[model samples]
Target chain A: MAQQELEPFFFRSGQEQLFGCYHAPGRGPKSAARKTAVLLVHPMDQENIRSHRAYRRLATQLSGLGYPVLRFDLYACGDSEDECELGSIHRWVEDVAAALKELQRRSGLSSICIIGMRLGATFAATAAVEHGGLRGLVLWEPVLSGALFIEDLRSAHDKMIRTFLSKPRSTTPDEAGLDIMGFPFPDRLLAEFKEMGLGQLEGSPAEDVLLLDQGTDYSALAGGLEATETRLTHKSVAGPRIWEEDPSAGLIPQEALKAIESWVAETMP
Target chain B: MGCGDNALKEQAVTFGAAAPLVGILTSPVASVSTGKAPEIGVLLLNAGLLHRIGPSRLYVKLARFLARDGFHVLRFDFSGIGDSGRRRDTLPFEKSSNQEVSEAMDHMAEQTGLKRFLLIGLCSGALVSFCAAGQDPRVVGVVCINAPGFSHIIPDSVVAQVSKRQASRYYLQVALSNPASWLKILRRRVDYLSIGRALWNATFGRLQRSKSSASTAAPDSVAATHGMQTQLENFKQRGVRSLLLFSEGDWGLDYLHCELGKSVKQLEQFGAQLEVVTSADHIFTLRQNQRELMNRIRTWCLGLS
Candidate 1:
């Protein structure tokens, strides 16, 4: 049963106009913030677009369970800003902060949990380190090594070109850097990603962190927080790689979502 | 709600009977050379299940480009797609999609006070916009990219089979031409599932398809062509300008040329433009290709009467 309509609006993040959706708690309003507020940090580039259905479904499901959830598009993504070349990890981190501020404004600055996937996991991890102190952190397939992530993107992109197209666009890293699917990542941005990694984090992303394993091992990076006294739990979740093209596959991975939902519900203090 | 000092703003508006369908409006920040906003509105439709962002967020880039150039652009998710909610009614996707296009047009008419709109869509979105242009008098022009359904209605299996055939051929070519491709196969860099599908489709699938085609000539294919002919006639009667944009060598374009060429070619007499982007895929994923596509769209829209 739906209690209220989802609120879709455009908000400002520094100089860019970013698009975001606010899912009001299905059973209750903002009355429950610290315990039920969830902010989703989406994956970047084409991965973000492919995983959109999952994010919307997750938001709806969480809202139904009485959590006010927020889903936002980073700059140069979704209904946000347009230029693909303008997207950078730094700007995306700022976008996360702006979205969190908006979520906090609605939650009266209460402790809000953050759920991130892929590249977004890196952004959330970095944001958590900078912002300091969060209720919970769900790092779903976090990119532990930025260089490895870029290589993965490159290989996937090569496969995409071979599968769908006869001749691909130039990828010599000219002014456009390289084309991943249709999104353009500049060389400087790619260089930035190469220099960053979750292993480089000196502090914990949150007091309690749930790392959903999507076939990627994160124990070494997870152990990096041993000195910070952060509670870390690793859960292996069998879910389709929604980032890849598989029309027959369901967009929402039920098992993975259930694990997260259970973690959020049980993690509530 | 665009922020900052630019005269342009991205406004969020909801329309339809319950005002349930949501759309984002991107408008000019300042008056253009003519000192006022462009009179015609550009309405973007969702490409297949990809939502309003267009394939690879092309619609977003296209929207901002057009807005900055003084045209108002509206991108919205249809009901049950993207951020939009499901319709209370159980209308099939085809009928529901057409209805949504008309509703979007109505919304545009109300917001811009513009009587006419220029519509653009990709794949199935293109089909929806074309159908809407045939029905909605408010549509003066439409740009359809790799639209389907004009192609004969084949079983879903055949679609998958075609994909496998392409993959198999591509793999065969790569395996023969490049030593690295075989190295990838040796290391299993190329997924086994993909190879298996390709082999299965190339062998057993081909035999099955041949036998199936011998038994069935796709009875409705001719009827489908005739139906498209009538629709093109309707478009002409309504003076709706149609632009058929296709990627060279795409299956959709192949189907168009193979099955519905005669009917589609007839539209050229009435200023219906047909363009094929060289070296482009179904979605024109390349920046140069997209620029060509967008430039073509911009020129056609601006030059429209």
Candidate 2:
């Protein structure tokens, strides 16, 4: 809605200031009464590109429901100020933490939730461990294991290289570095990614979690959170694989959006 | 790797009659060149549905690259795209896009007192630049990268058939050379019927051209070519330098060489320079390809100075 305030600004995350857009609730009867805020975690690489529109739409939908939503770019990604080669998962987790603090301060709401897609879901899970008072977590087609995620990235990278390179050479997992599509994948980041797994984490930090399964069966991810003092909700949502090789066929799954909207309304209320 | 980390200054700007268009102006922090500032400004357009970032942040890098070269570059999203507000005018993209681009140039001129402009775009953006150049005499040069179906007069139905023909012909060529293609065909991953159609077209289709002459002899087809030629001739007459870059790997190469026939050479003789990247993707997604493309652009910009 035009009445909704969309503020674009930069905030500090360690030494670098990350770019973010805040979607505040419109001046409605429910606007001032709302206290819950949601911070969106974007998926890595091309998924970010394909999912940009859907995420913006999702933010608008949430804001219309009187929920303040903040969508920010991770360090070295999107419109943020940095190079892709310098990005690391550990740094991005910190970036998420920084964004959470900024969102809390801006919205003046201590009750916060995180909605992450693909790798963003993984980062959210990781950051939730630090912010123990989170309202909920939404993992949209999240990657359960770091190893499998790296494997998928490698496969996509190889296909893209073979398509683009004149003398395309296959890259090995043990290689010193990795470049998926155009974004650089430093070996240090690769090593950090290889060691991460939702199951391996000590516990889930949130009281409730919603796993919006696009296709993958997240029984393992659910079991890990179930072992902790956490309630895990699983919902199957059929949508376009935004992380697929060719993002040209941009498909925003209406079903998935509806599912997310319904879940946010129920959880945040 | 990105504008030497503050070698250039960038600011978000909104301009247009309705102020519906938004762009980022990337200009050098200090004069990088001693000579008089380049007379031309750069306007980067959206390739297709992609935002102003271009495909794979190519526009961002290009803007910074040109800025470091002491040229002001403006990369903007069109109506209903990226962060730009939607247009209330409800004009078709074909008409509104040219007006929006012109507004961007006018914005740059107002900001920096630069009147001459260079239009750089990929795919659909290239077509927009071509159309915009025809409308504005302030456009001194244009760099169209991998823009295939650029004719203004060709009907959509004809363009669709041409695209299909070019795609089919391309796949047929790939199938003949790459064993991986044959393997995909064997595995039913490749559409065999389309391949067969393409093969037939590539083989007997040319030989059977005389029989199909009646179908293609429409007055519209002739007019489309004539229109395209006249546009190029007009650009030449106006002293607007044109650089047409085609990636050999792109289907656009087929459209340029096979579809446009010898008219391509005629345009070149008319003073438009055509350069082909033998091993580059349609979007130039590869970093090296992007570097090469930027270098070519920098050289062209310098030559203009």
Candidate 3:
């Protein structure tokens, strides 16, 4: 097995810095798939923490198959510079653009693609739409609507209060925004999430698109994708929602990973 | 407002043999404290499976807060937990964590010219800090937040329902006391099997109240408490100061009382302090609680002789 050279660094994303982990493939017979470099945009908030191990594994796995991969923490998220209060959907979208640019600079390859999960996919889609010319895109259970996503989070918070916080509080959750799960959901970000959705997006972001859904219907997202030369592959895998699962090493859905690996191999070949 | 805005500079670093671990080193633009020793460093540990930034980025907030007060801080993921690669050698976490933590101190010393260090952690991280601080004499102080009893886990065959040794959960007491929980139970929303297990745990007595763990093989509750006492005594004899902070709603605080009823006095006798936050859960899920916890930590660090 070839060694994977893992490098952690902070690079300039606008005025601040964003945390990035690069997985470079060692010298070996490269994978048969296209020479396009891959960039992974991760989910935010608690979903980001829960899916971190899985993302790392996915990056490692892709690198092992001879593709250089970059996974990054957007500004105000993870080890990146700035605070959560400083985070915004607009800024996060720019972070995605910056990350894609960084990935391009690091790989020195013309053909490029992206794999984004949850809201990460939404960000990737939004970025691809704005920037254009992605060779391919993989959206694994992408959050189609930011409003509905926030709704799910609000629902989760209600359940959390019922289980852990039995006593009544001096202030209601709605009174001062919400501190869902553990991280604070700033009111500005909440408003951003409510107003932002893929429904508001127009045009296809990539020439080749793969939508991987599990226990959700997001077919409507690509329904109006209007790229004449584009190809869209839709598939589903058997697995529970990983975002809700307690994070541990190797708790990732392997079947879903395999589906991705297979689709990557078949899509561009 | 949370952290890492202006006063502190964060540098990504790697340490340990072969530089296998990844950490963020936070240093203030200028040291702001004149009351305490200025050369002291603070090391933060991973909470449960959480990475370096910590749950809700609590470690980040605390690190930035302490850095503003003129202290160097480093928060890193344990081997195999975050950006850090897996350890090449196969040592279980309980045994390897202490060495990793000790190595963190060594790395801090070698990197920053700091001699004395302080360790901070939450839950399992808290337990590791307690154990590792005992091993390292250079450690001047230790902060343990919501630490569970280091007792072994009772197997499922022996005691199924008491696997967590936690009371804050909604199944047993939380449900029985709260009218809303009763409503949930009456609505058949709560699982019958869980209620049965809770009843069995309740009827079986100390098994639930004692050290409940996830492992099939851990020390008995009494033995674990004894182990903690030995470490507490070790701190006293070595003149190491300690702070055991707990939230009023966490199972860890309840476990502390259950295992050692008068042990709070023992803790005080040995220069170990206990501060329980009234408005927080185990993770201090609320921002106000995090502020209080951070305040307690800063005060304790400043007061360290």
Candidate 4:
């Protein structure tokens, strides 16, 4: 086994300073040289905590396999020096672009791969659409519909309200309108997210997209893709939903990690 | 609009003690007609990674609410966190000890001349408040909202699993490094064992009893209130009243509530009041709900005074 080393780095996005941990492989053969550097984007809210160790493990594994990996906190997240209110879809996309550029700069790698979980995946997809030179993409249960996700969050919020109120609260999404996760929703963020749909985004098309759906089916998202050269791969793993609150019950499927590693090995130039 | 007319006057101060705590003090913007002067004050705690900024809105709103209801409020950054220049780099929360918190309470008490105090802690702040309540007599009451107790209780079995994982990782790293070093590290493994124990106790000890009851189909409120009762009793021995507030949708509380009822029932048994605010997230960000919750708190604190 080779000694592994990690370097801490910071990049600026607008006025906010974002923090990242870059992991690089030790000396290796040139023929076995890794082509793509990966940027690992974490999920939002409590999901960040739940998936933290797993994300670190992913980064470690990727680096161990001779690829350079960078794991960063979104502005207002982790050790980043910005307020979370500074976290918007546009700002997050900008942050990803900035991170990708920094990853390129630090690794001196030509093409890059993005591996994002949940909301991070949404941002990666949006970024890849606008920016060129992405070698591949890996989305772990990407949020396809921001509006629907927000609606679910709102529904959860409403349920909480009802439970607290000790009265029946409206359950119908139509009646409740578009409010999720305790935050009021207009179409601003959702419209921007909807526009970045994998099928609609413009680029050389994602080289390859590996969607790791925990419980939900990704058929619709897979079927909707119009990318001429892009390959879509979907895998469902039986593990605990990392985003949910129960830590004891949910298991992080080993298959998911294996699939991810396999995909990276196959796709990397 | 003037500072004189404002219900709370804000000032920045620093303590010259070890670790040198610094914070903002907000006194009643206006004097009460009774001239009784509030004897109780509040210390606001921040959410994760937010420092004082996390609690800025809550503290401002709370300060006004409490001040109008007749209590002074102090909102300050923890050392190395927020605006405070010191960070708890090597010291974990338990080991960093409560030295900084005690100084903050002392400074607030001395400045305000308030004989009684209440702590409003969110997330990590809640843990600090718990520790502070244990150490300070001036802290007569506490309201901990959405605190995870510590990072140990995210899953019921997380502590044990994490401990095992950490031990394995440590041993594996040592084994891979050198066989002789592995033996050397094995001799000192007791220290790591103690660290694991401390981590477990710090993280899971707070939630274990309640979690066990929750798993057994016990009412969540009962279990939660029981946990609160024990915490409040610890506070009560020091003359501190306890209030445990949880929002409806907070996923953290979902499991506990399911297993515990409202926990309020248990809190009342310990002479601590528990309140549930509808539609409020962990931080009570919703404008209308925040106002309502603040009003309820004002009424409660007023009754206490």
Best by DockQ: 1
- Candidate 2 chain A minimal-lDDT segment of 10 residues: A165-174
lDDT of 4 by residue, A22-129 (tens): 887645443257878999997764455456556766776788788888988786664454323435788888888999988888999978899998888888888887
C-alpha lDDT of residue A199 in model 3: 68
Q: What is residue B24's positional error in candidate 4, in angstroms?
A: 18
DockQ of each: 0.35, 0.27, 0.32, 0.03
Give the TM-score of chain A in candidate 2: 0.89
Residue-level lDDT of model 3, residues B1-305, one tens digit each, is 11355777888877765327888888876544455446789999999888888877789888988888778899997888888877777887877788788788888888788989899999888888888888889888999998865433422322332244353244553567668777887798877786676566556645533444322334455565677788888989998988999876576665676556555666789888888777566776666667778998999998883
3 versus 4: better TM-score goes to: 3
lDDT of 1 at B119: 86
Provide the RMSD of all predictions against the true structure, rounded to 1 decimal.
Answer: 4.8, 3.8, 4.6, 15.5
In candidate 4, what are the lDDT values of residues B1-305, reduced to their tens digit? 11223454545556634344445565665554345765787878755545442432455456645665557777666654433445425666554536666666678767867667787777667766766776667777777676555222244443343344344433443233455555766787546675556556545654765566546542433444455446667765665776666675444444334433345356566556656666555666454555566777777677666
* Residue B19's lDDT in candidate 4: 47
Q: Per-residue lDDT for B150-206 in model 2, tens only? A: 664555545655666666546654445667887887898977787788777767766
Off by over 4 Å in 4: A1-10, A19-35, A45-53, A60-67, A75-88, A107-110, A165-179, A190-196, A215-227, A244-253, B1-143, B146-305
In candidate 1, what are the lDDT values of residues B1-305, reduced to their tens digit?
66232656788777665226777888876543345567888989988777677777788778877776678899998887778887777887777777777788777777777788888888878878877777678888889898864432544543554456567756654454567777887897888897787777767865765576456335455566566677777778888888888886566665564344344566686557888887777877767678788998888777784
Alpha carbon deviation, residue B293, candidate 2 (Å): 1.7
Report the TM-score of candidate 2, chain B only: 0.87
Q: Per-residue CA lDDT of candidate 3, range A48-95, in tens?
A: 888888888888788877788899987878888876767888888899
CA lDDT for candidate 3? 0.77
DockQ metric, candidate 2: 0.27
- How far off is residue A61 in model 2, in Å? 1.6
Task: Sort every candidate by DockQ, greatest first.
Answer: 1, 3, 2, 4
TM-score of each: 0.87, 0.88, 0.88, 0.52
